[model samples]
Target: MPPKVQQKSKEQKMAAAMAGGKGKKKKWSKGKSRDKVDNKVLFSKEQFDRFHAEVPKMKLITVSAVVEKLKLNGGLARRALRDLEAEGKIKPVLISRSQRIYTRNVAEGDDE
Candidate 1:
């Protein structure tokens, strides 16, 4: 925020206190925030197509990556990664409760 705005607010508070009413006491607050929306639980046809086509070629693959790229829910991205791994288009590098990582299957090309 600009220093001038803060100065103005401070001046106003001082003026208010001098006018006989105690100025609004500073209160604790959860800092800056934003309204969040739920992730999509289902995929559109375009997203599905893009997922299958581009994901396999990506240098790194993870649930969060898919969710961000496809605007999918965590569960959906997890399941998609599992399915792709099962299909052998991507190879799992690690699997854990916190995260899963995968890489492109260089053994195969776009024969389909």
Candidate 2:
């Protein structure tokens, strides 16, 4: 005699797929919801200009300082600073595991 095998219904198959084949349900994290709200707020030109102007005065600019000065979230501040670095407006001084410091880019012959 052969053993009997049980077959899954359409809903059961869907449930399995939704649970990533693990039988355990996945839950959304609070950080994800907060990120959705942060995405809605765009970085403005005026804010960028202000950041640019402020960079030279400070010997080193870190993400926390930018966040405090501009009243922006950590992720947004980091992204904006990276964008400015990519644009050649600023150059990084020191990058460590915990923090990165940046300074304004100075040309070869320009006296600061």
Candidate 3:
């Protein structure tokens, strides 16, 4: 007599599939790419003029704020804020060894 051939049950087949039979191996993902930063280390003449004119007019001024607005380096922004304060264009609202904040000098009035 021939050996009896057993058939797999539906549950058994499903279990085998669930076990990841014939599944593809995990691949190495390159991951999401980040855009390159092109921050300016030095300012052009026009940018410097714009920075001097518009920055003092802003309601809030900080190193990071200036950096984002003009794409400037942090040290450059800090120096700029210092210069503007010296020029009497902006008045310091907060001062500390770590950070400083400034606002437009309203008493000076708006002058082109």
**Clash statistics: count for each candidate:** 0, 0, 0
Per-residue lDDT value at 92 in model 1: 90
TM-score of 2: 0.52
lDDT, candidate 2, at 54? 79
Q: Which parts of model 1 are misplaced by more than 4 Å?
A: 1-24, 110-112
Residue pairs in collision within model 3 = none
Select the stronger candidate by lDDT from 2 and 3.
3
For model 2, residues 1-112, the per-residue Cα lDDT tens digits are 8898889999989988797757668786757443342321456888767876775556578888877677777888888788878887778998888888997677523356
Winner by lDDT: 3
Pick the winner on TM-score between candidates 1 and 3.
1
TM-score of every candidate:
0.71, 0.52, 0.66
Lowest-sum lDDT 10-residue window in model 2: 32-41
Candidate 2 collision pairs: none
State the displacement of the C-alpha of residue 45, model 1, in Å, after optimal TM-score superposition.
1.3
Clashes of 2: 0
Ranking by lDDT: 3, 1, 2
Top TM-score model: 1
